[model samples]
Target: MKKIYFLIALFCTVLLHSQERYFLNSDTRLYTSPNTSSAFLGYFRYGAEVRLLSESQNGWYKVQADNFNEGYIQEKFAATRLNAKDVKIKDAENPILEGGDAYYGGNHLFVLVAGLKARALPDKNSKIKEILFTGDPVAVDYVPVNEDDWVNINGNFDEEYARYTLRKFIGLRPNFETLIKDFDNLDVNAVSERKTLSERIVELAWNSEYSKLEPAYQRYYEVVKQINDPKLIAETEMNMALAKGLAKHKLPEQIIAFTKKAEFSLKGTKTKSLYLSQTELVKTFGKPAKKANVGDECGIYLSDLFYYYPDLEVSVDEKKNQAEIVKVYINENNKFIINPNTILDNSVSEKAFIEKYGTYIEASLKSPHNYSIIMEDSQFRLVFKDGKLFSVEIFFYC
Candidate 1:
């Protein structure tokens, strides 16, 4: 019975670890302990998605990032109030609002702004039917005529006499801090290989010309900005800038050149990385665990050869498939993860990287933003572009 009780406790711990939460404040700091001056565990951006851990005080809350880095944050940065008295929104200059363009689309949505009044129609003049608070999830029956107009939302029959409401205060329910997955953006080359919604959207936004992104991303960003993390705000600005740059460099080649010159990406998390000479490249990944795809179509100008391992893969360009530049890719099944500590989760976000490793490579800050890195004490190397983990390589140097 004692063992059974322990198993129940373990199950409860996992359940708490999986419960999604949000960093309601921008740049909320997570500390190693409950004290404000304790060691800084990590910094969370505005509206950054997190998980609620063990119960805590009214002033402090235990939390965890997607990376599984556990810490504590202040409570004020975590609460969402929807009451008319506590709902704080940027009041429009005009006290009254008008109807938005007619929308005919359908989907479940949420209320972004607190104290939003439910109306009979999409227009403000429509009779007020009910009141909605912040964090309230709803459904929408229509799409706005203009992409930026007020969205029409549905009411819950579960609520007393609840019906449809229309105003600019509504939002699509956020699946935590995720963005754009519903828009069909995925790195589906591998099974269930996924990126954080923010990373996915930012990636497409960075390479907008080659990306098929929806305008709805703009609307989504606006809603998420409420949490006001500086990191997210900067990315949003960069997205707009990339879109503008696309107009200047309309040609494909020119756009690529412009992007290379205009944008520089950062590593999401630093992992132990190492440099391989042409000889080392051939000797290491060349030992394939099973079969590897080798051909011109598989690599640089079809000139590079690639090797596959149970937990890792590497590609090199040379006379054979051995190229001077080598690229390594790692996924959940990569053989390098020889243990639980090396667990490679589907990731593009640095926070995820930091969470899983329990320690981030601070020295990686010195490495070139786009190159592969091997930490001084690490057995594997990670490569990131535009702040997302594109691949990881494992090798033995020790």
Candidate 2:
């Protein structure tokens, strides 16, 4: 008799534990520690359902909500307005919305926003019935899947191809088939063999150049397919976030810092810095380094390889213990002028040589010519012309 009673009690306990509750409010907040400011776990809208997982001693119950798991909520807030039977829908039928775009709930469609709104009754004209204000939200009654505007929705729903401008949204609905294929093709052990596919996807998106955001989007998609590293993904997504104007602060300095460390680049290789010629400087370290005008006039040729900025003009003059740099003209205008002194040195160090020429070479103090450094760094190359600094090649490694 005791065994029989134990079996009945276990079955009843399991049955009693299987219950769910639907959210009544339009927005439900999930707190990290049953209090605000802990961390936001995501939010749910009206009619969203959750399966009860566990209960806290202090009136807080843990629940498994959509995407979010182990969420805490006060039992007093457990009051739901949705009827139990209405929470779940039959797979055979789905609710449809009547606006340009609509989101589906349990048994209804909710219009997320109203912009150039339209409506179509079953077997009626496709023309819009009425327009709606920008911020208005309305419920959708039926979906017009068979209609012309709704075709290929699951396949192509980008904002550029969207039927209504206001209906477009960021991110696509999760495609199970594509996600499965992505996971299946991934090789956890080797990634170099799969680089071609990722490159192709990224190249195609970049070549389009339709929108400013397309490049970042392509980079993120390729990152998702090629690399499973969460840190890399997070870094790429941060770039995407900045590209989309989602970042609140100015990132110019951060971007410059990030670019300085990049070893490889999709673009050409070049390092930006001002290079001064010894023949052009009249002074060196508290004394005249070289003659500024040996014969007639001082000639300065300013060449911009990548043309990133305008030409900067600097005047040359001899000073005691150093060279004086003053901007005497700009863009053919002799206007701007400021004097700045730079330390003069005769000896070249390995680090300083690389900083100037992008490489280090055996520094030779050749007679007549003070020094000639053969660059070992791969980013720059220089050719001497007429015993002066000739063509300086800069490579920008992205």
Report per-prediction Cα RMSD to one decimal. Answer: 23.5, 24.2
Instruction: Show model 2 residue runs off by greater than 4 Å.
Output: 1-15, 24-26, 80-398
Candidate 1 worst ten-residue window by lDDT: 261-270
Q: Write the per-residue lDDT of candidate 2 for residues 299-379, one digit (tens) a residue.
A: 322321111112222233323222222221112211111112211122333223223332121111112112222222223
- Name model 1 segments beyond 4 Å from true: 1-235, 255-280, 283-305, 309-326, 329-398
RMSD of 2: 24.2
lDDT of 2 at 198: 43
lDDT of 1 by residue, 1-398 (tens): 99999889977876865554343443356578888788764444333455677655767778765334568877766654223343323223211222232222222445554356776544568688776654455554222322334443442222344354444555443332244545355444322233234333433333333223234346435534655678867655544433333334334343223223111111222222223333654454455565445555423322335554544444544455333223345444222232323444445454444333312221121242232223323223565566566565433343
**Over the full model, what C-alpha lDDT does candidate 1 score relative to the true structure?**
0.44
Error of 2 at 135 (Å): 19
